[model samples]
Target: MVGYFGANLDGAKPLNYDDYLKVPQLINLQECKSTPAHHDEMLFIIIHQTYELWFRLILHECDSAVEAMAKDNVVLAEKQLGRVVEIKRILVQQIHILETMLPSDFLAFRDHLKPASGFQSAQFREVEIVCGLKDERILTAFDDQPEALARLKKRLSSTTLADSFYNLLSRNNFNVSPPPERSQTELWQSWQEKTAKELVRLYLAPSEYYEFYRLAERLIEIDEYTNLWRYHHVRMVERMIGSKIGTGGSDGVAYLQRTLGYKFFPELWLIRSYLT
Candidate 1:
């Protein structure tokens, strides 16, 4: 009964893999139309869907970290971020899985799909916004989903991961800022601005907080890996689909190109500039 999963103590079945799979709705693969039978259609579905499921997990870990950071719960936030880094490794591995599909194989089923591009993936977009990719133009895709749109708008507008990093730097007594800017840059610029700000702050502060400064640098390393993963995805997709528009209506190659330029934690890299 539904009660079994609903925390009902009575008539509860012991849980194991076999027992769990016996349930009526434990991820039954629905039969959807597969075009031209790419001969590797199952593999294709598995890869993309698995990536999505992984994205969901990524969001779970990253969002928890963001929420923790907001409370200045540094220890808890680090744990959450550690989970995110673990998940990022998994996400990175999937790129290789997708590479298994040759260009010809992808093209066969490509026409079967409409313009339902990854650009329209609200979840991925949220992850970007969380990582400081705050371009207002990217928000138009979710106009139909008012709640999701609203949430992205809020995340874009508020203190993002970059803001949290800045606060972290401030906690350590760094007080840097960039040359006055009239507008905000999304992910890439977000990191740059943060870096630029922190570099100055750390230098200006009267000699102390070295330990806190190290923590900021470590997080920047994590963001660097994340940026690499995102760029790798863009390249992989570009290899498979070329500049042709995504089935999701996004400008395929151009979109990927644009995304490559984003850096989620600018301050880390900016400090590197000051290192020399």
Candidate 2:
């Protein structure tokens, strides 16, 4: 065990494990709202708290990856994005632990959680925004919480992972900008054609653009794992409550299911279909 203080004579405060981790405060945070607290409520609270902590870390990694990519540091960006992919896998697996609690057991304390829902997790929202999923409606959703709303507003206005990735490509001499004055569909088609051609070139000549090719793969992996996490989360919600409404008045499983179709990097995925 690491000692709190070394034997040196200089007067210094000692730190124990609890002090280092603030374990006392951490353990005390699980306050059960249900009167005659249900046994499963503590488990529910702890699992969700753990998710929020992990979200904080995920956001950190994503922001680092964006900054690295902005500086044309493909290797560092890939490293940070790889960390996010692994963290997403853990997020997918962690939801299963809740399945161990029977639906009836969950209901025993679910009602105690009124109007408060996981839908309002500010950190999770931040992760989505950083990863390139920006929706102004999300800003409206948090209108009641000033701090959370402000953080989300800032993220909404900032450059995202997609912007950084495309910027890196531009720096590498790729013409990623869309043609001017075209209809929305025509612009999309033109952009996709250009991106697909470049991606195919990179795929066929990986040695010529090894760093960029690797960065593209890392980005695709992040998109893949994010969708996987959403898929598993939907199943977990379905298992927990069937079609029942969520604690925050949202369509619980249905809402999660819809999110499964969202992709952070559409051009990356489109390139695969266009590839021979």
Candidate 3:
């Protein structure tokens, strides 16, 4: 039966849609853990599953963009970053679909999800790390999950998108040296000032540095859409369960609200104020 479903047994068959994408396996993964299997539970599972899949694709595009930038291929990096921006738009829109589920409908299955909160989403954290939002503290939560812990550790130790961008600028002869790491907040603020000054120069002579100017704008779009996604997410969560604690032991809406203030590329945003 497994062979009939296009398993690699005998290895003699052409690939079909199910073989290529494993549609059969993918469709079967929505097994509801709720007692009696609440109808809304399926929607909840599929929505979050789709989110993780999109998050995976976003991470792929981000890595590609960073690689392209490292190679001084601004065009390729811009193209890949454009793809990430579009995917984030889709992410923002997807929240509304979950909001369509009435609060009572979610409550029916929410209890079954205790300790399985979206806070534990390893892929989402990977996306954050790849996009330059590394926080070592978050890794402590996944200590029991060795596979995830390993991946997060690798991300923590690696050069992030922000690092690669500055390196790209340095290759182009911009002064991208960051201040000493006395404190993360201080380092970020110092870097922000330095980067904004450089970006302001680029903005003034955009035709001369057309590619870098465009890259900076694309980075700003990424920052903008990320904040939009967070804002929409917080609104959706509040609508679903006002002030309630999250399934993963978080403060739920409050925690998400706090995250809205985080900017992956603050210099990209701050440059606007310095622009003529």
Candidate 4:
């Protein structure tokens, strides 16, 4: 009964482990859509479900990191980003777990997932937006889902990790501004160049900005692990489906390959080129 998960139990009844953790509800969430339920269908569903959970935690840590940067608490911000970097490592490793499924086994239940794709993962989009990958094209995919659209709109309007990092640097007397009257692309290029120069200074004299240097390193690690996840995911898909169209109407491996270039902290990585 739903009452089993209720928290109103007083002295008359002690809280049990199952009730405390909602184990009953959690275990029942996986529902295979395959007729007669193909064995691998459960694996596919659980892998994706687990991915969403990781995305949720990534969003949570990113929010905290942004808040820490807002307060110019670089130590706290770096700590939060450290957790995100570790989570991304786990994500990259976790995608390979899908390789455990034989291609034939996945096909047995693949049809049941048509029109429902990981492309619709709003939380994943939220994570990208929060990390500075705000693409409005993703909004069109969620036009039919009111809650997802609303959440994404809020994320779009929110300050991103890149914004927080730049603001933190500006507060510390770094010149983070781009000159006015440039075209959009030029403006972004100028901004990256400015940030890259400042990052080079940090790299050259890390002891002077040690906290910030560590924070920048964590940002780079997060971006690296994100690309690693994308790479592994594309390889896994290709291994399973071999350039086939995605169930969610995407170009499958090709579409994922395009995402390999996404960078949440471009300036952090660009600094490497100027390190010498």
Candidate 5:
């Protein structure tokens, strides 16, 4: 109704997905029960729809960050990344909402869905791959859809945000190639120290990456929240599904637990230890 009933109905032009997607039609909020899907079908639809909305935000941030990076618009990229961090918090917090459903509630609609799972969400997988969680098993979740699988594959092969930061450090005269673990040579150690200093400079002043630092911290925050979300998800799954595997054949709680070890920015984590 926002477009159809608004005064600017004819004038309001939708330029992007968010700007264009009107309610209900794209939302798909209807109960499957109206068409004999399941008892908890409405709830199921709403949860997934909400998850998609979050993915939209994630995509929006990523698009902005990439564009900013293309222009060497460090400040802009940082701001965009910061927003993503906020979105990450939102994603983590949503686990509570998901947990509200009792085992009985989900079991009512469980059978209505066949093979469809969160693992099948293309956008969510894109977010993971973009952030550099490049495990092949994660990509396997979408093998049924060649298009989704291809896109995920492309992102996995692309440079990640963490890679961007390292490249930036190298550009700024702080030679960071393999990071600390692989950096054993004295020359490498010297460069990493210099790189750390340059990072402080880049993230603190004289460049847009200053904003990028704030943004980087936000990303870290997002990771923390996402881990919390996963933890909560595992707990909820236990309460709801027990030891049963995920809908996409993942090991459910065990799978979620495994994801907790994934890191998007290895350099950022290393900096704290190096600096302190």
Candidate 6:
């Protein structure tokens, strides 16, 4: 028997904040590979661990948004997506915290991270997959880890946030369906154009289609913040390592630069050009 806050609960253990959040175990997880543990290594580990937590939450919210949209609940879907947008803002800011570390400080422990890099974050990849960036090449990186590969495969085959939003538009009588039997990039561009044509109407008369319009705008914000995060991350990496190859053997800054233009909701962005 123990007291929880004030009331007594018989035959039950009281829950403390530390116990509930597993603070002890969580704090212990930042094991630095550097012998003697470089002073900046703790900062490096904690920042990335925090990112994984945020990525998990982002996935949770995105999945909820998808479910909400599937049921034609645009308001709830938008609400969930709004959380993702704000979290992405935090993600952009969070990466900059690494910038405070001197290049010399990071180099003290850099070599210890060979073959392991942010590029290998499976949860982040799942976030990309859930948000509609399905590239099979990413899967090859996880061949040695079956659990992550399985999750990525599930996310790849599942309905993405973009798929849900476009389906919602279709239910509202928009022409989002693809031209039959088209293949490859041509088919992809055609689908984007067709969806963009209808999406433009939402922008033209936002108040008339408030639900769809609001949700679409939220998706755009999410996409925008996603790009912003990528841009900032690239800048941070460039600052920390210059032209050096990544610990994960990636091209580092150059590879990150290539990811800048990715959009989770391309049609929503395409509508902007057609606005006038």
Candidate 2 TM-score, C-alpha based: 0.91
Per-residue lDDT, model 4, residue 166, is: 83
Q: Tell me each candidate's TM-score.
A: 0.76, 0.91, 0.92, 0.93, 0.76, 0.95
Clashing pairs in 5: 75-208
**Looking at model 1, which ten-residue stretch has the lowest summed lDDT?**
176-185
The TM-score of candidate 6 is 0.95
Model 3 residue 24 distance off true place after TM-score fit, in angstroms:
0.3
List, residue by residue over 1-276, the lDDT tens digit for candidate 4.
Answer: 224556444535557899899989988999989889998888888889899998999999999999999998899999999999998999999987899999999888888889898899999999988888877889998989999999999998898888888888888888884222223678777778777987799999999999998998998898899889889989999999998999889899998898888887777888889888
Tens-digit per-residue lDDT, 1-276, candidate 6: 456564447756567689999999998999999999899999999999999999999999999999999999999999999999999999999987899999989988999988888888999999998888888889988988999999998998898888888788888988785222223678788778887887788889999999998898888898899899998989988988999998888888998999998877777778888889
Tens digit of per-residue lDDT, candidate 2, span 107-175:
888888988988899998898878777777777668899999989999988878878887888887887
Model 3 ranges off by over 4 Å: 1-12, 178-183
Better model by TM-score, 2 or 4? 4
Tell how far residue 250 is off in model 1, in angstroms: 4.1
Model 2: how far is 245 from its true place, Å?
1.3
lDDT tens digits by residue: candidate 5, 1-276: 246534455676536555577654765556484345555666667777888888888877876776666566778878888788777777777777767777877877776565677778888877876665556667766767898888878886776665665665455565454333322457645655665555665454535555556666765765676667777777877888998888777788888778777665544555665543
Error of 1 at 90 (Å): 2.3
lDDT, candidate 5, at 20 = 71
lDDT, candidate 3, 53-85, per-residue tens: 998898888889889988889999988888888
Per-residue lDDT over 74-170 for candidate 1, one digit per residue giving the tens place of the 0 to 100 score = 6777776667677777777778778878988888777766655666777777777776666787788888889878888886766566567566655
Instruction: Please give the RMSD to the true structure for each candidate, in Å.
Output: 5.2, 3.0, 3.9, 4.0, 5.5, 2.1
Q: Against the true structure, candidate 6 has what lDDT?
A: 0.87
Instruction: Give the poorly placed runs of model 2, Cα more than 4 Å off.
Output: 1-8, 178-190
Candidate 4 accuracy as lDDT: 0.87
The candidate maximizing TM-score is: 6
